[model samples]
Target: MNTIAEHIADFLKEYPPFDNLTFQELSDIATNIRVINLEKHAVLFQINDLLHDSFYVVASGVINLTTIADAEETIINKCHEGDIFGLRPFFAKNNYMMTAKAREESIIYAIPIAVFRPFVANNSDVLNFLLENFAINSRHAKDNVNSNGKLISDTAFYVDQQSEMQYIQSLAYNNSPLTTESNSIIKDVAILMTESMVDNIVICEKNNPIGIVTNADLSSKIATGRYPITETIDKIMSSPVVTVIENVSLAEAQLLMLKNNVTHLCVTKDGTSKSAVKGIISEHDLIVAQASNPGVLIKEIKRSQLPKDLKQIRDRLSDLIQNSIQKNIPISHISNIASEINLAIIKRAVELSILDLGSPPARFAWLSIGSQGRKEQLLLTDQDSILIFEDVAPEKYREVKDYFLRLAKRTTSILEKVGYEYCPNGHMGSNMLWCKSLTDWTKQYNSWMNTPGENSNDLSSIFFDYEIVFGEPKIEEVIENVIFKNAVNNTLFFDFLGNDALKRNSPLSFFKKFIVEEEGPHKTKFDIKTRALMPLIDAARLLILNANIKGIKNTYLRFKQLAITDSKNAEIYLSCAEAFLTLSKFRTVEGLKNDDSGQYINLREMSKTDKEKLKNALTPMKDLEELIKSKFQLTQFS
Candidate 1:
């Protein structure tokens, strides 16, 4: 009886739903608990299984909530000590959407729903929390996108859930468009239609639509010589023009188009020819606007000829990221897609730069530094990179160097034109020192490692995320190998890197207020980049470097891998990864709000609750830095 009460209390204390019950109440409930023991792979609940009077809580071991993911049996969530299971049946029609199986020999507490219902009915907060969490947990959006993989939905929920996605397919158009004078000649009227790319040109007097000349009018009257080409367009135009007002919904627009058998709709101020036409919305525009495929955004970026268009694409990308985040995308998939978008943007920038240069003297590879190099950059920040060219003899070095330098300068200028600010520290490829051959880069890295100094450390940081944006893939691999080989077992270097990484604590105080920067560009503001992101970023880099790991350059993934390897620090590292996601979200939002990098936060404007949460988040980051310092023996270096 004592063990039963203690076990129930133990499990209740760890989870929210049961936490509402007091010890005496829980003890009274626990006495009637039915403890069930199961062997490995034994099913606790199956699909369509009738409601069991009792819900489950893990008491002695682990349970796997297995579902179909990517076409195979997969465990989506693991339930451990004090974790509840089989509750989907209690609140959700008493049928299991997923099967719960014991991963090993385990004992589970069966808390009868009959006794729990009364407590839940009386406690709104308890009930509300369960309801919300249950939806979030059970739907678990990452695996639900496609319905075919085992434990994953492969049926394309991203495509399937259009209504849920809230996409508005229709373009708002105004009727009663500004039209040419009724007596305007064919050439003059034709120019206006051509410039506007309108299918039809409206003829008006006093800016009031009186008639419309479409493609048919030009073909019949102008081409057939039924009327002279130089004659007034009023002879060919159709009179009694139909008009509509702006703010029509997609359905209404479609209906109007169908009813009038017209391909274009003119939106006006008052839905009459007497009112000025605001704009035209074509059927093609409406269809394209409805496109849900993410690829369209990339295509738009590629086709953009101006900086403002690319900027709009970037803004769209931000919206896309927020959508993915809100839709509960797995961070991995989100980063992967985002990385592709960044590459597309950079590639287009490179293409534009190449166009500007007219022609290149030699083959070269453009490298992206920092987060971008790692295939992990999810946000735009300072452009850190260099240019690597094929080798040139000493006599010809200046010729080759000048050519690449000019190219690099043009490339960065175009990227800056597209909104990636140049590196404040002059780490961009345009720097003469940065435009080097692969051999020079390899040799340079060897020198940095052998003769390590503060400058070398700074160089190492820049080189760590060296991703080749253009040029030969082989040379990029060669440069990477050189850096990796030198970095491995370079304990002194790791110590230095570790010390640098842990130098800043998370940005908030124990009291949860932003720690104001003492001086420099952000003297009055909170420097979130240095104090919050950089510390975590540096720690992740050291851990990955120390492990001799490659490819996973994103900080979150680095910490995730570290957690898998370092059992002792697994929880701390996992929490760090979560905090990073939250912090990244916060920073991105802050940047979007203020039109800066979002690194320099304005603390005074933040809500008290937010300040408290921000402060709370920094502790884990501080602890993470401490762990890195102790693990790497960075204090010895300090």
Candidate 2:
């Protein structure tokens, strides 16, 4: 009885309809429910059947809501364990549009609809969940296969309704972004052109761009000395630069560029110069920002004028990682490049944070920790960073700490908006403890190392991977020197780190097929991070740390560095690096297709040929792990 109740509770916890029910309510419902077993191809419901007193849920096996489309049967949503169906259509006074069939052997529960309706009226959570599904399922003709027979493919709503995302910048009409102020001398304007490496600029007055000046203006007028270098910009500059409003489409912007024979245009608040210059768009800036490829995308990032612009730039960053992984680019190189971009973005964020606070009271450093520190971050993973400052007097300590704290908070916010999802547990530099002085960081490292205690594993996991990201580098180096002083040759430190590394076992099992998941949000899959990625990362970090190697955080780089130094074990280290790279590529391509973290992989999705490639890649990782176990005498520990 208890087992039955617990199963009901567990099922309730995973799903929306039952989530709000208390244990007693669930137990009472379960006690009253009637369970039935149905064989394959059994009919659960028929068309035009009056609504039953209860809702039917699949306890196990597949129940499909399928409809015919284009003379073919289409299954909309497959219902399995704990999946509740038949509630929405009937509750809304709709006749059963189709039939529900058992696609496989099934166990089902029928819960009285009367009991559920009262709860729906009272519970906002349940009502919202029901409404969201009702919206999707009802609008989708595909749901007809489940109950009302209808075709859904032609009318799947979300297929085109794009919501807000990191990318997708809408183009607007505007003035040429490049400009020369009317008060500036023509000579200074030419120098500005040369410095900016641009061929044209819009000459403007009172923040409203008037007319354009280009190489043509310089070639015909300045080089010929029609206007002397000392002459004011208005003497030779074209007056009244073309301007347009913010809702201009991409096509209009292009046509204007072509019609005026101008390479640059300034975007203004209004369609005319009566308003201030809002932005400038260049033909080259548009052409190069393909919004797809890495080479072009990086150019776009460099040209971005807003956080919104940077959002698009960051969106392409994932594509860059995905492509690099697909092409089997070294994860080490991939991580390094990604880390550089992330560092640049964070630096920009920190700069904004400073300005937002009026100004920084004193100088400080923003340190990149964990994956970013090692620079092996192939994905936009968790951001673990810390703040370090130059030591101030005792009386000013509180004042300085508050300033840095506020700055870290602002920087972290921009980072979140740019699509590195906020760390679930707040392991970021925004936390007060993480934003500290150089002395405090040194002390933190010292405490974790020498006085390793019960909670050492968690602390070591974070601090051991620290490296400087933004701000003063010398201060970080000072902290590094202090950490190594307490850490190297420390057996307890090595053991703790080693144990944590070993926790992520190799992906293989006794059967030799890669062990996959049974179930969760991503069930029946293998987590790349835990199995393939972690094993290599942990081994590299452990082996390098054991050798007293420092400064490098990226796994492949660490392995390569260690390989050069320890010629004896270099071959194995190199193999591990390659293995890591290969796995990263696999996960990357998989992620690009799905737009996810590129962690879990569906074994079924792999082609037979791809499976062979994966098997080959796994061999090096397996051997490396075995070698580590043997070298460290980890067998006994296991």
Highest lDDT among the candidates is held by which one?
A: 1
C-alpha lDDT (0 to 100) for residue 253 of candidate 1? 50
Residues 174-237, candidate 2: write the lDDT tens digits: 2345666777888778888888877777776677778777788889997886777898877876
RMSD vs true structure, all candidates: 16.1, 28.1
Candidate 2 matches the true fold with a TM-score of: 0.53
How far residue 68's Cα lies from its native spot in candidate 1, in Å, is: 24
Per-residue lDDT of model 1, residues 366-454, tens digit only: 88888787665656677888888888778887888887788888778877876788988888889977878878888888877655664
Which candidate number would show the highest TM-score if scored against the true structure? 1
Worst 10 residues of 2 by lDDT: 160-169
Q: Which ten residues in a row have the lowest lDDT in candidate 1?
A: 148-157
> What is the Cα root-mean-square deviation between model 1 and the actual structure?
16.1
Error of 1 at 528 (Å): 1.2
